[model samples]
Target: MDHLTFKLGRPVTRTTSQFIVYPAESPDAVRHAVRLGLASPEIADGLLSPGRIRLSLTATLVAQAAPGRPQVVALELPRPGVGLDLRQGSAAPAHVLSRFFGPPPWTERYRQAWAEIANLLRAGDVTDTSVVVLTAGEPDRAAAVAEGLILGSYAFDRYLGYRRKPSTERCVRLAGSVEAGEMRQLARRAITVAESVNFARDLVNTPAKDLGPQELEDAAAELARDLGLKCRSMTPAQLRKRGLEGIAAVGQGSPRSPRLIVLEYAPARPRYRIALVGKGVTFDSGGLSLKDGKGMEVMKKDMAGAAACLGALRAAAMMELPVQLTVFIPAAENMPDGTAQRPGDIIRCGSKTIEVTNTDAEGRLILADALVLAQEQGHDAIVDVATLTGEAGRTFGNVLSPVLGNDWTWVERLLSAGLTAHERFWPLPLLAEYREPMLGEIADLKNASQMGGYTAGSILAGAFLAEFSPKTPWVHLDIANTSWSAADLGYLRKGATGVGVRVLVQLLRDLAAESVGSEARRRPRPRAATHA
Candidate 1:
């Protein structure tokens, strides 16, 4: 893990650096550029009007070698991407930022962009402690730019033999009266979140041999203990006694049997209580319905949902959000052996019998039992996150996560939280029309659609889990596409994305706020003096 540090210092007029970054707010307003002594007004204007500056209708970034500033190189700062419209007309702040910020408003996008900038500066022989991130406009937004750099430069290379020492120690100086304390706190929280996200990615990146069901349980228990939260894991005997047959069926193929991990965050009189269930298939080989060698290569990440839920739990514990959270992870490995579950096998999940039509559709089976357990435990809402379907990826690409649920309000709340956290989501229907396709001839339901697995797979998976949810509001997040990056996307590198940590953290915070506001409204206010 590459740990990042930040320092806050007063702004200065004339600073010397091998590289200087300038935000191009307006081409006509060259006062700041003139003040920085980059060039004379006429010269700067002439140099900036070239094809590089005027090529794009969207904001532009122009970097050039400064003529008289010795070794100094200047880069023009602009919004991240070109012509992105996330607001299909919604006036949400996150959407507004997404539309205008050039970058897709995802923190990782900003992080990735800034990381690249730092690499460029380092590659250009600017091996100093810090780079000057000078910006235009309100100047306060410089903190955001600073955060991007801090988070984007993160890397996980412990398993690799080589380590590259990074230059640029701390001071991310910008021209503003930004509160040093607030800036530090921002960086600190960003570091915490970044570390947690990276931790999740690490778990996902680890091979199944090292991170099996038992190993993942141990990791979760360690995180819980360190975070000062309560942790407990149900052994195979316990799961079997409680009739968690779906879980048993999935893990029986492996010598390392299934375990149900439960972690609790109970603050002093928590304002709200919520349940979270994450799918944890440590290594999925699709059981008897085996996948090809290429398909099974990345199966270690089938547990990303579980990793994300654990990461979110860690964040909530650190932030001490005024909410009680119960996290349930159904950990298992789907392997092919004599003991492995086969297609058409009947497995009992809670009170319902599920006919395993396709052993590949095993995630929802374990999730069903966990969700039922969450409901029995009592909570205001229940949410399950999973990398459950490839069809979802084919539909939305890797840009947006898909959400399906029974409650409109909870679904909408999750979507809103996603936008606010910059982990955007889109809603999919759990339509009654498709619910019928999940029925099994011999059992209460089928693990998969008998017709085929391709059509509306994600939503059908949600429908299957819905059978086990409590009367409380429940939401299902399908992050199949958003769980990994093929290449570096700003803040995120080419590995596990740790996609759900921030979104769930934000959701808990919102629930805490709602709880506080509701309490305040109920409190007795002073009866106005109505003396006639």
Candidate 2:
């Protein structure tokens, strides 16, 4: 399974059974190899020729129609020796290779394709041979391959004991030559991000019976302690004193109390102060409004945004980004009980009051308190992540996250980061006209909209968040859609996709770099100001 790269003229040796991709489809070479019994021209023709062929698992010996050999081998374009064709490189070619090698048990060809691509990325090159290396054999070439395989193999099968073992395949490996240092760094970063995402996924996947608001607070505190960051948790009384009525009201009905947990990481020479607020509704029973049986099934994932924020913080701290970061998580559960906040209840937030038209619209209420606290800390910019609206899912589906921000520059930068990370987000308008729906007669605003159903729920939520920070640069991420996927694709596994963690980390890194550059520009000239 060792991967080696050489130019065409170099001496070629194959000690063990190996697969090679030739550049040309010359009949002469095929005939010669067939005569020497070195390869099977028919098998080679089947693979090298255009069009897809799905060989049965029972089929043996892809190289020859001979008995007791490897099952069907798939081959496609650019032949072997012809240079890399970026246009022709695809999962189809890789699948052919997977069929040839026949991966180990419980592994899928798609996962192998991902591993192959990751290997090529680590090698820092892309060409015709790169595709072959990705598909032809076991991924033993680069350390980065190990990293990607470990990452793509994650599964949340903890609750599936009674169900039959899923036939779904997982696991991938890559083979290619790569620079050791760069490969190691890539592997390390991939592991760091994957582990963080897995952490978030685990938290989201946990049953509500075990991970209540208090438990979530403890988990955050533990993460802070482990990362050597400052952590603080506010009790119900403290929340009431701070006028965090939104969070308090939501949690009053549950046996588990509400908490406002803050984690801070201050660099020595901070360039910019960034605040992240997350809505951590551990479980959403929809309070007095009450969700039906169907709506309640996935209520465990309501805290997905909070989990992502926490995961991003962990990654940032681990990477030691040179920015002052403050993470605020308002952890609570919206449950139905005699003491629960009713639909008609009016709660006073930090700077304004909000009337609750629907108890299910509780995420915004908790975020209201958290955002106020973030602004009070005097952050230069703020980003809040929430599983706040189903309208977001209906609008953007599961692939794209909807982002609303006041600052165009920040929003653009975030979108760039999302693209680089392969996560998707679309910026939505925050028009002044949308503000009217949230206005309340008695209170400053209402959590539920008076009109405009799913058409603009994401934008409306963002408009509500804008009320707390009138002047501060802010971005609201409504990740209701991208947080989880029922099906697998690319490197993403099903359930708790941990979609925003990488994008957030990348954004923070970019922000830190910009802050450093700004600081350099703002440095005081010697004696110039005093003379002036």
Candidate 3:
């Protein structure tokens, strides 16, 4: 697939093929467009009628421009009816505009506006044209235009015969404070992240029969080796030797066995060490507690968490971020067989024993050993990602995953990083109140919190993993819903969403940047992406 490239250049006047992207965030923004020559003052006045405004994306304004005049492609804000409350140009009108256009969370509507811009370009099949993005002041908001374009350009039709690559590789020229070189750099970064996301997407979309623990480990090893990161993998016996019984237990049913794969990128004298553990259930059949056929169909994507970690580590290494990182993937295919773990079976996970009450909840079991291993390594902080529960999906849907942890500050920072990266999360309270249901009568903990009335299955899963590392500044990301989608949404294909990779990569970048800032720093230079 041909990747879209954005080139930054000094702004200039143009005609014919030229397209203008104007943000109609507020009435004042519309007027500002006039002041910037993006629109006529009369056009700004016309916006007051509401009828003149296009409610979604850049729509062509015919007879709106004279011969030789640049085409005005106005981007309409989502939910256009509510934003124009006469208080638009008040003292602190930015508060109104921001509130209206930039909701505190995922301003997905705003992104949709941007996505629609791509939709316009793609629809027209306009190729090799320069798109001049117009905005007044707000450079951050301006940058989001580039973000949405790249996002909207994402496609994963490689398996299909008639698959066509995203059309129109336009030159994206930003008419703002962001330098062309900077915009080029941001595009490169976004592309690298997107490519990794697509990499995870490919991994999760592959059939589990062809992508067992060994294949998953081989992929990680190849990525680590090519990216200059250290790679190591443990066989089922090695896992048993290391006392990772919980990970080994669920895989006993499958002939493929399990693997404990570790990839490390240790830069010299790195300021902080970050450890990430991902649940890599290549395919899940729910073991002895088999899931119904409907529930088992999409089990191949269960390894999305592991794919995400691999993608994040590869991106960080590819970007040469100055942070030491370690990623653990407890990979296996959970199936029901004669030797499969039973409902009442017990397995040793790190220092504690967990009773398997529901084999369908096998994600947490593998993650248990991986989390303990990460915490034991003395990393500065640890975070685990898993598609561990259906309740999480039921509660949050495919929008924001649930984040829980003991360290509120770290959770807040990670979630904020997710927000900034456009991979949002909603914080679920990790109250002590949630832990009561996790206790196991026969063992230290139970893999399944099937106790009646405890409908917070996602939270209880987090609570169960919490038993591994009690005091580490750890964060838990339950990506049960966000990992895959039945319908495509901006940059996300219908299958694996490559959910956590961007957020985790963003977190590492932010940490690396934060460290550099504290020491009289400079933004790390971008490097060429590593090839297979």
RMSD of each: 10.7, 11.3, 9.7
Sort every candidate by lDDT, greatest first. 3, 1, 2
Candidate 3 lDDT by residue in tens digits, 1-532: 1123442110001111222233344332232232222232222333545444322121122112111222223322333342222212111111111123544443455455666555545444433432334443444445456555555545544455665543334543334333444444554676567567767877888888789999999999888878877899877787777777987898999999898999999987776788999889999988888889999899998998998998898788888888899999999889889988888988888778888888888888888888888888877778898888888889987778998776666787788899778888988766666666777898988777744665788878877887786646688899989999898676564778888998998888878877444642332221111010
What root-mean-square deviation over C-alphas does model 2 reach? Answer: 11.3
Best by lDDT: 3
TM-score for each model: 0.78, 0.73, 0.77
lDDT of each: 0.66, 0.65, 0.67
Ranking by TM-score: 1, 3, 2
TM accuracy, model 2? 0.73
Better of 2 and 3 by lDDT: 3
After superposition, candidate 2 runs with Cα above 4 Å error: 1-112, 115-148, 159-175, 452-455, 519-532
Per-residue accuracy of model 1 over 1-532 as CA lDDT, tens digit each: 1123442110111121322233343331232222221221112223332332211211111122111221212222343222222212121111012112343343444444555554444333333433233333433244445545544544555455555443333323233223444444554565455556666777888888999998999998899879888889887678768777878888989888898999999998788788888999999999899999998878889999999899888878887878899999999999999888888789887788888889999899889879888988868788899989987888899988889777777787798889877788898876666668887779989888833544778778877887787365688999888998888776666788889987888788787787465752232221111110
Query: What C-alpha lDDT, on a 0 to 100 scale, does residue 509 get in candidate 2?
Result: 72
For model 1, what is the error of residue 481's alpha carbon versus the real structure, in angstroms, after optimal superposition? 1.5
